[model samples]
Target: MHIQQLTIENFRNLATQTLNFHPQQNYISGCNGSGKTALLEALYSLGRGKSFRETQTRHIIAHQKDFYRLIAKIIDDKAEHLLGIERQTRDYRIRLDGENLSGLSALADLLPIQMLNSDHFALIDQGPEHRRRFTDYGLFYQDSRFLPAWQRYQYALKNRNAALRDNWPDEHIRPWHHQLSQTAQLIDQLRQIYLNDLEARLNYYHAELGGLETLNIRYHRGWAQDKTLEELLIQHLPRDRQLKHTRDGIHRAEWRIYAQEQDIAHYFSRGQQKTLLCALILAQNQVIQESSGKQPIILIDDITAELDPKRRELLLQFLTDSGAQLFITSIEALDTPKNRQHFFIQAGQLTPQS
Candidate 1:
């Protein structure tokens, strides 16, 4: 699936715009704070049902505007449809081909786009939420059977957490805990398999990116590895009550990034971290291509943010060879002579440059 066109109104600094895009590759170039990132965020929101940059939908509207609208013309094998998402009176209306929809998962079925911004490195440096999103997105792209199971796990988790907050009796929470454990065990197993596969892919790309380092990706569950999720929750029931939250389970899991036994986040320089981020994203591209027949739309904002010339060239080459359609934002035209199509974003206006 690919987006042929995008129409935005009162979204961020963009007041009104309709821009056509290429199916294979698109380059958006502009200076800092020139709405380049906003364009990418708009595309991401259309596909993912929320802004990649912010959590609240209200923040996406222009400063003085009370509402915002985004529409994308998507092309798929069956037919072409207009996926429209609009916000009014603090509620979102999702429409496909002019028919109102109930949920955003329908949007997920139509498009699977991923964005790689500078903050994407947080998947390594920050909390489990980031790593969980990364792992779940990878799973979603690789395995079609994961979505429902994952959703059920989340539902059970929320209910359990609510029970803990409400100070419910242990017997009352026991059934939810059991159900959550069953779902979590399946998720945990699948996550381990995917991480193992991702580690291999990351190593291969890291070598190609000239890192030449042995990388180890480890998943840290909230409790001991040997303990079943149900056992962990039961053991921690008293502590969880004292803490007023769910203390141990899959929700607290984290992904540890390591380079040859050293934590990369603590030891690696900024440039090294950026390079690792690029390698991981490229590896994701490879995984999706190999595991599924679909090639995801990759949005790389500010392609040359902090890297030197050599690393930039290597990243650009890797992106070109990944066989995924890329939408890259750069300050100036890239030096690579790969017949790239460029679009210029200036003062909230976007126009094709090449």
Candidate 2:
């Protein structure tokens, strides 16, 4: 799917702006703090429920503004769709073509957008949570059912933790623990499948991205070494109650990125990590396009950061070959063919330049 156009109001530095986007490739050129990243953040919020840059909806609203709204025209092989999102002081609403889209998942089918940002390097340079979230989002893109199962697991986990905090008896939490385990088992199975697929795809794409080394992704479960999830939960009941929390479950799952049996988090250079992330994103887009018969919108923020000239062209070519619409942010003009399109963004305003 591709976004035909975007309308923004009171989002970030953008007071109000509308632009007809390129269905194939769009390059937004700007200097630092020119609202280039804000544009991508707005588009990403259409797919995801929150901004990739900020945690709260109120933070995205312009200063001195009470609310913000964004709408996009999405086009696919079947039909055109309108996705609208409005945020207020207390609540948020999403609509698709005049119909109320109560659940944020409704926005996912309207537009599948994949983003590559500087923070992505954290998957390799930081702790396990970042890598786990990256893997989970990738799995979410593939399997729709995983979301509800994940939601159920999170809800049960929260309740169990609250119960522990209240000094509830161990036996009183057994039922909730069992319920959490059931959904967590399903999540674990799906995550394993996705990790296997992701590992294979990453291997091939890593080499293609000029990283000749083999890349490995390991999913570590809290009870992986213990007995079945059922047995582990039963065994850990007392320990968890003493600790006053849900100690063992999918919430504790981790993902480790490695190269040649060595931890990449401590070993890989920043440039290598960025290249690996690029390959990972490109591979994910390719897989989605090949399987779903529809390509997702690709967003690459701060494209010139730590990327060599050769790798940049190669990455751009891969995006072009994917046949997916791309929104890339850069500081300078790219020496592409005359037919290529670009927009210059300055002081929160966007205008077509090439």
Candidate 3:
């Protein structure tokens, strides 16, 4: 999917404006605090329901403005869509093609976006939540059964946890256990399949992106392999009751990255870690494109930071070859042949240079 036009109003430092976009490449340039990243944040919010930079709506809205609004004209699979979002202090509204939508998933379905920035390094440096979320993002687009199974598992887990917390009888807790075990198995299977595909693509992109060491990913299913989820849950019931929550389940599942059998975080330098993260995201983009046959919009903030010229060029080339619409921000305009349009932003004003 590609955006044809974007309209912004009262969003951060960006002045109210409407700008056209190229289908393949768009380079946004400016000095610090020039609202370049805010432009990308506006677009990212349309795909994801919230901002990656700030979580609070009060801060996201322009100073003294009651709300912030974004509207995009998108082309996906040869059809045009009008997507709009309006965010207020405590509420938000979304509309697609003139129809009011209830949730953000609809927008995510239509506009699959992959974001790259300094904060994303957490995929390797942070805890299991980040890695699990990374895996689930792919699974959400790839597997039809993932969302429902995930919802069911969450529901069962909540009820099971409550039962333990409230000291419910074993019979009452057993039913939730059954539900949890069943859904857990399904989720575990789907995640494994998705990870297998991701690992293969990750290795391919890692090599193509000039990575040297042999990289591997190991999956932990949140329980001993020899025991079924049902067995594990049964065996851990007493401890779970004592702890007032189930600790050993799919919710605790994690995946780790390794370079030649050592953790990448320890083995790779800061730059190498960032490069590997880029490869991982690019691999995700490729997997989404191949499985869904819909190209996702790629957003990169501060594309030149930390990355050396050679790696940056390789990253840009790979993105260009993927045929996905790109929105990249830099302190100064990059000298590149693939850039089709350039926009300069300063102090809330945006001017198209080409």
Best by lDDT: 3
Residue-level lDDT of model 3, residues 207-275, one tens digit each, is: 887888878889998988998888888889999999999997889999988988899988899978887
lDDT of 1 by residue, 1-354 (tens): 678889999999874988887776788888888889998898888768888878877788888788899988988767899989988646889999989988877776667778888888788688789988888888887777678878887898788778888999989887887887887887777888889999998988888777967899988765678888889888888988887777766677788779868999897888788878888888887777677666677888887775677877887677666666678888987753556568888888898875
Per-prediction TM-score: 0.93, 0.95, 0.95
Residues 105-211 of candidate 2: C-alpha lDDT, one tens digit per residue: 76765677789888787777777677677777766667877888999988888888888888887677777867787898888888888888888988888888899
Give candidates' CA RMSD values in order: 2.0, 1.6, 1.6
Scored against the true structure, residue 331 in model 2 reaches a CA lDDT of 85
Which scores greater on TM-score, model 1 or model 2?
Answer: 2
Residue 24 lDDT in model 3? 91
CA lDDT, every prediction? 0.81, 0.82, 0.89
To one decimal, what is the Cα RMSD in angstroms of model 2 from the true structure? 1.6
Better of 2 and 3 by lDDT: 3
lDDT pick, better of 1 and 2 = 2
